[model samples]
Target: MTSASAFWIAAVRARETGRGAPLFIDPFAHDLAGDYGYATMAASERVAGGENAFIPVRVRWFDDLTMTSAAAGVRQIVLLGAGLDTRAYRLDLPADADWYEVDRREIFQHKEPVLAEHSPRCQRHIVIADLGGDWAEPLLHAGLDPAARTLWLAEGLFFYLTEPMIVDLLHTAAALCGPASIVAADIIGTAGLDAAAMRGYRDWCDRNGVPPPFGADDPAALLHAGGWRAEHITTPGAADANYGRLPIQPGGRQPGRTHLVTASLATS
Candidate 1:
């Protein structure tokens, strides 16, 4: 499978187990995965001692948080580094709400054909561009309407970016979003990038044929520095409680101090 294809494979596994009855319940994710070759990836993980157990759990947490923001009055949804995510199709939202997904050209190239085969139940728009580049321009050009209330998601993408890139991404998002816009992103602290976790992450990267990027020490501070006020920060345990699940094991192959944060763009 290509690097882009591998993304959906991982997500499919998470949706199947994590989103099942007691979990997140993203019915469309599994369907999309099966339609796009992620079924084979799920079987592989099952045989390899369930490599991506955290995905479903984390996705469920993110889905809940995103929905909460929408409930609080966010209408436009923007997903950065979307990478085979099916929230646009899976989640229910206001009919007028617009869901925009951003990712690399290759990711969209792989996703479009599969998704086209199965249309989303909601209003879904795809923006194909690289986050490290001037992708924001296309987003604006696509009628994102920066003046409108929006909820931006940057899930499973920040840790793969350098400090400067992360800064640029946030600043750009803040510039484009209107007042009261909320951004949700997941981050890993320094400890989470320690030897064990780094090794595991590196192994995953190696297998996926990609290089790993630097992890942040204090994401809340970083987001604040980029002109966003931190609203809520939820760790894995906190997410477990918020979603009514048992606390995950303290030490796992994943990084430490991993957190899901929600921030509002500061009004100048």
Candidate 2:
């Protein structure tokens, strides 16, 4: 039951960090993952593969947007389902920035010991809750000002959630975000699930008990329906082009591949 998907991404970040010149250097990444994450990661590399262009590209895109939000005057950040994420410790965020990381209590338990050894770049608040349950109440009570702009990061969260859960989370975000808030999330879709190459990865998720039944044929439209305007939607190919990360595959990229979507509150 401790197969934390966040651990997988943290492992990827560590791999990327060990490189000559990384896209983002998460110094706290390696220890946060600890031994088990690295073990699963080695197995993943043996089976599926290493960190793909999609992951690092998505990471950088959101990092830039987060700084942009801060520059634009948003001082609060809420990382929902924030498993082993170390942005509060790594990013060169504004000194006034406040971060709230919400996750299951166990994730924080695993992360806090590692976090105690480092100095966070911003003020950090940890909220433990069942994200599928009443997670927001704890966050709001923890001093997340609804009237102030906050950058909400969902990252690798939505794929594991069912449709009703996703919609409910979106509505909650919209209600809490106020105007000028930005939300960034990465979502798997029908196209990715249906890909011949992605089957192995799907099997990996299934084996790990995280069956991804929630995906979209049209990710941008899905966000629009969920009450946000997807101002930027980048597919794997486009992200590769942006970061010069992935080589163009043979034939034009197929439809419904993974998408990194960035949106804003549409409460006008």
Candidate 3:
């Protein structure tokens, strides 16, 4: 079965594509999302009592960061739990750059058909493996060089994992990264786990078979423990991350706020 969570996110991207001045566009998103995705998204919005701009903003932020990494000469880009992401097909990447997407076999089976009609801007490698287990070996076997400067993205993925899993994932990526390799991820703060505003969404996740979202109080500290130096961290409404779409103002604490982070490997 196609993952409900992955389709739900694709549904959000599809909505973005229809916006007059969208943050980013994914032409293949609507088909990828399908009727199931739209239904799930509508149900989620009804449960949460409104729409959310978080996913759209998060998508835009990651896109910008990926382009920046490519421009900086990072040749290997990996997306953990890649879901229905279409960066390889949509983004303008360097000719020599190779983008690797890691996710379960089922998701790829569902995704590959939708993308088969499109050509990617860069070399795309699909490594099918369970993220909950030892996926590093498969990635290396797929031609991910541990010596190359790489960009690792864990977007919209960490909340589904436990703290230990998150740590293991970070360490695994760090082990495969060379000096100055970059890692960008979006994480919910620990406060989001039980925040009143997140109750409905949490329930929605539970009903959909997705675990309740959990995260660190200090994501920087967590990254530090895995030998990654947190270079930038910002909440959704912060000046750097906001794209004039957030309902709340740019300052003050927002309930269930997600943090966008960029970190670099501490050493080769």
Candidate 4:
């Protein structure tokens, strides 16, 4: 089977796709999710009340961010944990743009047939490898220009990675990307884990084989320590200004405390 989190995230996209005015529309999400995907949504609804709108909110944010950056002349896009993500097929792209998704071979096995049915909006490449290893060479082999401006998204990925691993990824991007390359990803703050939605998310992760092993209170400081410049950091939580959605679970409600971070490598 595919990763459990993969099923859950895809279900979120599928639900949004079926909505009247979704924050973003992902046409391939339902097909990519398959039967298990819909079942996952039903199961979550029975366990919890439908799916939390948080994942899709972040997805729309990054999707818009990508287009905004691309309009500014960014031609390369990389998705580090590109599981069940339909962006390559859904988004409009400049003719000069290229997209890369680095993930295990198993993940792409779930993607190929779907791509056979649907066309990608941009030039897309799949680099099959463990993200924690020497995947950079394969990325280069697949035609990523380390010196070019790039947009990198690692959404719904960092909380599962160790701090050292996250630092290594930042360092790798710094060494490989040009000075203007921008990266957007989600990170958890220490206070976020205790939030009701995140607490449920953590339980789902542990049951699904991926557990929450890391959370940072100050991603700005973490980025500074990792030698990157934090351009913007915001948490879209209960009654967040932009998203305008409150996370309600049982009786308690707290902020999502998720750091929707955007940053770039600092100049020497």
Highest TM-score model number: 3
* Residue-level lDDT tens digits of model 1 in 43-71: 55554555544455667777887778778
Ranking by lDDT: 3, 4, 2, 1
TM-score for each model = 0.81, 0.89, 0.92, 0.87
**TM-score ranking, high to low:** 3, 2, 4, 1
Q: Candidate 4: lDDT of 22?
A: 78
Off by over 4 Å in 1: 1-20, 31-52, 195-197, 200-211, 239-256
lDDT of each residue in 1-268, candidate 3, tens digit only? 2278789899999999999999998999999999999998897788666777788999999999999989888899999999999999999998789999999998999999999988999999999999899899999999999998999999988888877788888999999978889988888877667756567667777788866676766778778877788898788878778888875445323444578889998753
What C-alpha lDDT do the candidate models reach, one value each? 0.71, 0.77, 0.85, 0.77
Model 2 — which ten-residue stretch has the worst lDDT?
247-256
Give the poorly placed runs of model 4, Cα more than 4 Å off: 44-50, 195-211, 237-256
| Weakest 10 consecutive residues of candidate 4 by summed lDDT | 247-256
- Reference-based lDDT, residue 220, model 1: 71
Query: Which sections of candidate 2 miss by over 4 Å?
Result: 1-3, 49-51, 195-211, 239-241, 248-254
Ranked by lDDT, the better of candidates 1 and 2 is: 2
Give lDDT tens digits, candidate 4, residues 1-268: 2365687788789888788777888878878888887786777666565566677778888888988998999999999988888888888888668999988888889878887966788889999978689989999999999999888888888877878888888778777788688878777667756755455667766897864657887787777666688888776653332454544322112234567778888875
Model 3, residue pairs in steric clash: none
Worst 10 residues of 1 by lDDT: 246-255
